[model samples]
Target: MPSSTSRRTVIKTGAVFLALGVTSCTGVPAPSPSSPSTSTPSAGDGPSAAFTFGTASQPLGLDPALSSDVESYRITRQILEGLVGVDQTTGKPTPLLATEWTESDEGRSYTFKLRSGVIFHDGTPFNADAVCANFNRWFAFPAALRQQAPGSSFKGVFKAHSDEASLSIFKSCTAVSADTVRIDLTQRFTAFLQALTLPAFAMASPAALAAGTADVLNQVRGGQPLSAFATNPVGTGPFSLGTWDDASVTLVSNKDYWGERGQIATINFLTYDHPQTRLQALLDGKIDGFDAVTVGNFDQLVKRGMQIVQRDPFSVMYVGINQEVPVLQDVKVRQAIEMAIDKDTLIRKFFIDNTAQASQFVPPKISGFNNEAPSLGHDPAKAKTYLEESGYNGEELKFYYPLNATRPYLPTPEKVYAEISRQLTAVGLNIKPVPVDWSDGYLQKVQSPGDHALHLLGWNGAYADADNFVGPLFGEKNGEFGYQDPQVFSKINRARSMPQGQERDEQYHTINVQIAASVPAVPIAFPISALALSDRVANYPASPVLNEVFTKVQLKP
Candidate 1:
């Protein structure tokens, strides 16, 4: 995860596009005019062509505000437009529908100038009023919606403006001008600009949202509406929903899109529950791309002529110790457990070379990463001594691990947990392994912390920020770990308050040091993502952000 300043610098440096090579992949020989071609047709062609792709799982919803998962956000990216959009070449936020923006000195008030002549998929005009109406619906949802909605990941993060008479009618946030809106925050946030790049901030046209005489956007709150427009989305994006077959979704290109017309005129997204089936489909040329490649078949795919794209995703795979448990409450015991395991050996055996051994909770890709922090290296003798000192006798401990086959970008969770259990038994600790299905197990563990003595878990960074790495894990009232440190919170708060400069850097450095000393979550390894793509697909870029923008993709002849 990169800091705001680092992200800005990266954007200014233009290294992202240079490293990836932004030139469109063309020049391939076109097939015969009468032959079947995978590429979509242009406007010149009497009937535009469509492209199809495959994924491991189905998307949860089409509504941008209701989406939180990767698949849902990927689909939302095609149907919604935000004020600022992420650059495909770089992860930095750039002006999109909004032509320009200005911020007050205090950074509390921001005004945006909307681009002219934008229309929704339903032929509705998109303007400042539309933006306000969309935000109003989003801000109206309660905290419970986070669990109910498909993409309500950051539901409680922002508080809308309250006084409607003094300001705008769009919930808590107010609109100042026809093309400008003023967003007043409850507190100063350094990552607000980056947050705006997320799908939750997408703009929706009021006319389109209210077209069917049903409150589709507000249906999650239990309103008396039998018909909702969310199922049939209306947006100013490149694609419009065509057919939803429960197992697959079809999208057609929006002819009236305001920007450069997309190369592909249509897209068919097919979802499969099993990774093996998806991989087989990709290899057989039945689909263009698939994710969550299994470790066993990764090498086989490469041998069979498949393109593998790798990236360091923002996830920390670690063993969470139940601090409330009497055996794990002691700091010495925790340190002993950390030292007992050989992380490097585990990485070498279970993961490829690309997977890095983690010494701290935050991955090295994140900004303000502390390379010099003291790490707990493998030393079984020291671990034994600490265990003896803590008066640990032979006692049995039950460890819970999910039996999920596909967990975002990881392999089978049960296999990883079994290896861990074997390693723990090698030491004096008596271990019992319990495997449960992912869906029920994941919800139970996250909702009720400390359900097990130790469990395997992962965390993905919401944005490229150190605050994202720290605030959610250790902050009071957040995560399963109820650990609170005023000094740590103060340091993070200082970093958030300071402008982009040396002071902010110094504050982050302090927070990192504090976190290293007080290990709330033990960092194990930063795994690398492996994506399988067919030769027909072109211009796919690898990114840590994990955003999906396939409009530029062109299929082969």
Candidate 2:
């Protein structure tokens, strides 16, 4: 929903100021995109001209359909091509595989005109039939496959699959003609086009899927679950997988690509879990660029003449509250937790300059932001009173926080946890710290049903839509929050089908207020994340949603 150019806003304190000019028409059909430079450079696609990027962790899986982590999406983005692309300046939907599209049937049906002559990396035709095949695959995913791939983006967007077809938004996929395809939905989703920009919806080669046994999760890489086809996905993108090992993941440019190849012939995403290690790697000439530049490294990068690009605040770091926990079921206890947090203090101490305290999950830049949403501001006296009113005895609540990991939203997890824990304890709440290493399945542990009562997690907005923020996180009852509010769920489901206008905006405003008042989770801060690069790079496409494709990187000669 947010797009930032050269415009900057001044922050009074340690944060870099930013001005947000959000576009409301996120689902408008964009004109046919000019394919990137189709001509190859004098040097062919090879590892000698590789540009290495430092990543905090290894990707969970190569298949975008199964993984939602930034690292995995980073790699898959180059290899996979979706029907829609994101407009860098507007954060709106643009044509990718499909040249143009039209919505009919009161937004319940969409027809796409397939781009002619496009072929998958496996030499299979990308036609109307191919489109249906991809759609059918996602719709018919077995119960076992769904269980193994818990982070299914399709389920998040479409609502369900064959297991619960009655509840699914998807109704049918039809090959209207050789170059035309149509999709029918049970309900109208206002952000349907915007949600298609997610990497998880990218197309994969049908031939390769059958040959590689895509359904079988029989392999493991870097302690991540994966299928054979996931290890060797085939897509009609600008790059193809080269090699993945203990050192790094390499990609070779697709010589047969239809668009601009730029100057980069090969790309490398190297693992450097720590911010200091990443900074050291860049200084040592081991890598060209890195993401998640923390407060500690920002000044150093500026002083050393490294290029640091700051992205607009497009993510929310929150204190997750699971309603399943008996103690947290009490509304007073939840209110106490929210009131106890001093968001201003956390932002000043741990976040970059210009980071704003968030009162709701939707970013302020988004259209649905409720200016009147009520916040239980920091009041230790009030929090103590709420706690006392709830119950006399204190029940220990396990707070989960990832260790040795740095995210765009949560820069320093350990430090942030310490401060938050202290504040909760100050309010007479019993808090137990559950520090888990990020690489040791911290996300799975906290996201799934477990002993964690409170967890430090956040949602990074993927496209320019309010549903992109609230639907996947709180649309329905899920393991992460274990929050099941039938009224809120019904309201959101109704809002999803409404056409864009004042009524839709008002509906979201009301929803945000409802979510905030109920206190399913405490919205803490909207972090302003940045990236650091070496002098060798002239330009890098730093996106707020992390929708960066390495082919856009331009190097200084």
Candidate 3:
């Protein structure tokens, strides 16, 4: 909405698909359902050295704090500046808006030294007060507004908002001075800084927030409601929003940007709902580069002399189980469902060659990946037996899968669902297909409260921590899973506060193992995703955590 191509299936470099904690950025209206995939470029006020990119889908929303889709982040990464950024080499959080920071109060507080001489796109000074304002804004979100954002970055990361103040980790944000900002947490969150690196924590212009009514969703674009500020986001990044239309989103280079400006004058993200359209666009020189290269397009692209860049495995495609379904409430039934799925067959047929079967959500590169995570291996006979023993009835389970969408984790939803449905049917379980268009609220419908017994979805790691994977998916009573286990919840909450060491790793390992046994969802594979590029680009900023920013991109002579 994304695939792997090469025999090795990955570039030596690694990158994660982070739109996580669902990092959606606020932006202009979304494209209409019937809108064309291409847009008109504004020549007069647009960038001189323009770069057009092909994308799989239109961004759901622009507010990183509210949405969690990849397309939204693709644009936001250029226009927004997070408090921190991820280092390409070490996979650790580095200074961005905050030049340096000190951890005190047993990891419960952080004092940041703001970078001087920085300003947002709206000419608002980027200072300590700005940082505190953003933090305070997140900490004090109203419950109704919190429910409005599908991604809910603060609710997912901090676990609470103003309504449940006592339960929240965010205690206060204080402007220690014009250049210093102090954030006090009610509890230790060892990954606080790492979490801050998310685009959702990016600082926006205070004046723009007020002028544009950032919190108000007064406009509807592409079926999703947003605000005026969302339409024209003002942040201190390498690019600023120039124009947004049905066919494309145009971003002009920020003339006042403080960092490396690179050579790009404009970036136009052209939406191509299908993989072939993207390939054709690049072939026709309609774009400089494109992402989400699929398996079907690999040989054709390679034969046509396209440069394919593969990102290392970081996302886990899974079949989400909603316990609210009467039949799914039985643990035996859930175990049977997992056992019926042949990971080997599924990956070999639908995924890139080397995609590894996953036992848990956390990737192997992360500290908490458990080699011994319990898995119900493929066995149709065994699965049938378990289902029969659990009082088998002809109950049709509604399985939801998105249409016209491609993602790093889920490259082809329909094909994947067909295979999975075939496997599940082999074990005598009644199956029902509920297909939803990607642009038509597919993600929200599945993730929100619903009667969907099962669904096709996955998480692309936002940060380098296990919490980024498990914490958001199983942190609490998520509408998607409806998995309520107090013990598991306590363990996950405790693990988030542990220092990054053996003890913390062990705790995460335990949590992964526990979740596997509980079977809230089935972790299928560590998918290898790739991007296709035009020869015009000498080098692209491919990051392991998807921290690619246009400022680092280099152009060919």
Put down candidate 3 lDDT per residue, 439-534, tens digits, no spaces.
888888888888899999989877778888888999899889999999889999999887767898899888898899989999999998878888
Candidate 3, 508: how far from true, in Å? 1.1
Cα RMSD (angstroms) for every candidate in the order listed: 8.7, 3.9, 7.3
lDDT: worst 10-residue window of model 1: 21-30
Residue-wise C-alpha lDDT for candidate 1, range 392-446, written one tens digit per residue: 6756666777653354435556667777777676667777776755533343454
Least accurate stretch of 10 residues (summed lDDT) in model 3? Answer: 21-30
Q: How far is candidate 3 from the true structure (C-alpha RMSD, Å)?
A: 7.3
> What are the per-residue Cα lDDT tens digits for candidate 2 across 1-557?
11122113211211111123234343345585454433334444432467989998888788888888878898999999888887666665677888788888788898888778788888888888877888888888887887677767888788899889999999999999998889899988888887888898898988888887877889887666688888888999989999888768989888777666666778889998888999999999999989898888876775676777878888999999988898888989999999999999999888877789999988887778889999989999999999888963789999999987888999889999999999999999899999998767777777787789999999888876778888988899887888888888888888888877789889999999999999999999999888888889888887877888877887887
Question: Once superposed on the true structure, which residue ranges of model 2 sit more than 4 Å away at CA?
Answer: 1-29, 33-48
**Candidate 2 global CA lDDT score:** 0.83
What are the runs in model 3 whose C-alpha is more than 4 Å off?
Answer: 1-10, 15-48
Task: Give the higher-TM-score candidate: 1 or 2.
Answer: 2
Using TM-score as the yardstick, the better of models 2 and 3 is 2
User: Predictions ranked by TM-score, top down?
Assistant: 2, 3, 1
Candidate of highest TM-score: 2
